[model samples]
Target: MKHLSGKLFISITAYCAISFSSQELAAQSDVLDINEIGNVDISTLLEDTKTFNTIGMGIALSIAECHGKDICEPTVDEGEIGQLIETLDQRIEGVVSRQQNSEEELTPIITAYVDTKEKYADYLERLSEISKPEPELPQEEFVEEDLFTDEDALTEDEYSAFDDFEEDLEDDEDLDEFEDEYDLE
Candidate 1:
């Protein structure tokens, strides 16, 4: 009777120990982030999946390392390795679908932006052409008459010299006397 009791005690303790270990391992598994949940755009998610292929490979390699020598070749049906791969594939597919849908939805918006940019460029070109200074009205060719007599052709310095000469002659009485003495009429 004591042996039977001892066996039952051992069984219960083993069960509890197994249950605790499983729970601890489950807790160690990755959980999705809440911030990631809200800010997930399609393109970003697809990019993430594309980058995650490396991680997926790493995980598979780890599984292989752990179960490489296991009995019965460790069929995926009874293992988590194949299931993890399948989950990754499903995640990639979901991301691809979302990316496709987002691209389809944004097509018009992208087109509109490109069209607007082209229009603005054309408008700027036209404005630049319009605002450019035109060839100045053909300048008239200026002609100079005889410099000795033409007042318009005389520079300010030349005019002032001529005025000074005229004043000196007016002040000279000899010129007046000579003119009167030589008069025969």
Candidate 2:
């Protein structure tokens, strides 16, 4: 409850500050007091107040963000801002020069890669052409391959051995006798 009341009080205070400032800012948008030498416009005073408020809020947010860490404040000093800007300018120039140098250095390598890629594509195209199935020959032109040629004739001795084996198996009487000896029934 106490914390809630505290937050509510902060909200009210912030609201009042913004509301009162906005009322003071309801004049000519041009805050430059040109041509009038001494007197300043009410809007000019409000704008200056708003600028200070914004800067203060920025500092407050930065401090809050680094609440628990070491080196809580901004690293830059009031005097070092110009030096930091100069250092950044030098670094940007260095980066641009390095990019140009690298492009010059790598040009040949990039050209070689492109040439090799084209050559590889051509090689693959040739492989595809070589791998296509050949067209078949017409049936009239196709000849069956023969297993034997002119020197495969049978010999005279082989024919004589076959005739003798047939003559020896012509005894049906002896064959019937052998059958009768083996029959049990």
Candidate 3:
């Protein structure tokens, strides 16, 4: 009787221990982990277009990788910097449109855009210090040929042909037969 009671107690204890550990693990999974949060400070990087694209960012990455620590900014010219920002702005707007304006999706893209803009801005400021005015090359004399002179240029007859072609395209007998594919008003 004493041995049986001891075995029963041990079995109960073991089950309870297993249950507690599993419950603890489940609880931990439900909580947010601080380490997994995106906390990388990108404020120092300029939010410009050049750093936004893969190629431009690749050049920037090479510099960063070569440097042991984070540097303050890039050293690109002011015009180049502005171009970069404009390009980045266009890209961000396009992405936002495609995502249908969802805040969750826009958040990371916006952050990256801003960071690139800031980095390029910094690079522009630095460039102003030792930058020289680029020497202007002699302008080439304009030798113009009219676009209308091109062999593919549409003539009055060609334009009329397009109308005929469009009429032919609209004359699809199959479209009317497939009315069941759509509901009529």
Candidate 4:
């Protein structure tokens, strides 16, 4: 009967421990600020993750070292823990506020940049229209000036050569007559 009572007590204690641990985990998870952490840059995110991991490991080691000692007592000072949590909350809020301010400050500069870009594009379009080449109309047919007037005379030898060339042309017969005489057809 005593052994059975011991087993029952151990079982109840184990159940209570499990329930308490689960509740603690749930409470810790509720306090996590997803939005505050999400806004952090990649470099800072990595650094913070590394720092937190180191701190968590140190705490875990401290707890392990205190095993079987009075230092491993389950009792916690709620006032001190609450103060630390509040300080951390304030820091997170400050970071979030700073991020919001930076975004607000940049808004006008971004607007001005966009406006300047649009105006530059409009100016370029106007310049292109003004600089465009005009279409060419059909040019007038060129009328060459008379290089030699009637006052210019041909020499006698030049005239005779011209007459001889004309007479030779008139004396030449058609190719059909020449072919008929030769019986080439």
TM-score of each: 0.24, 0.22, 0.32, 0.24
RMSD of each: 35.4, 33.2, 28.2, 34.7
Supply candidate 3's per-residue lDDT for 179: 68
**Residues 105-132 of candidate 4: C-alpha lDDT, one tens digit per residue:** 3333233323433433443343333322
lDDT of 1 by residue, 1-185 (tens): 99668645644554444345335434422331322322355464434333333333333332233332333221112234333344444443444444475544544323333343343344334333332224456444344344356555778898899999988988776677887899933
- Specify the poorest-scoring 10-residue window by lDDT in model 1: 69-78
Which should have the higher lDDT, number 2 or number 3? Answer: 3
Clashes of each: 0, 0, 14, 0
Which ten contiguous residues of candidate 3 have the minimum total lDDT?
Answer: 32-41
Candidate 2 to truth, TM: 0.22
Query: Taking the tens digit of each residue's C-alpha lDDT, what string does model 3 give over 1-185?
Result: 99668645644553454345335433432331223112222231222222243333432432333233333232233565576567556555655554573433455656676676677666455454442545566555344466356687888998999999888777765566566567541
Residue pairs in clash, model 4: none
Point out where model 3 deviates above 4 Å: 1-76, 98-104, 131-185
lDDT of 2 by residue, 22-103 (tens): 3443332234223221234334433443533433333233333333444333311233323323332433343334437554
Evaluated at residue 122, the lDDT of candidate 4 is 40
Residue pair clashes in candidate 2: none
Off by over 4 Å in 1: 1-39, 42-78, 104-185
The positional error of residue 150 in candidate 2, measured at the CA in angstroms, is 89
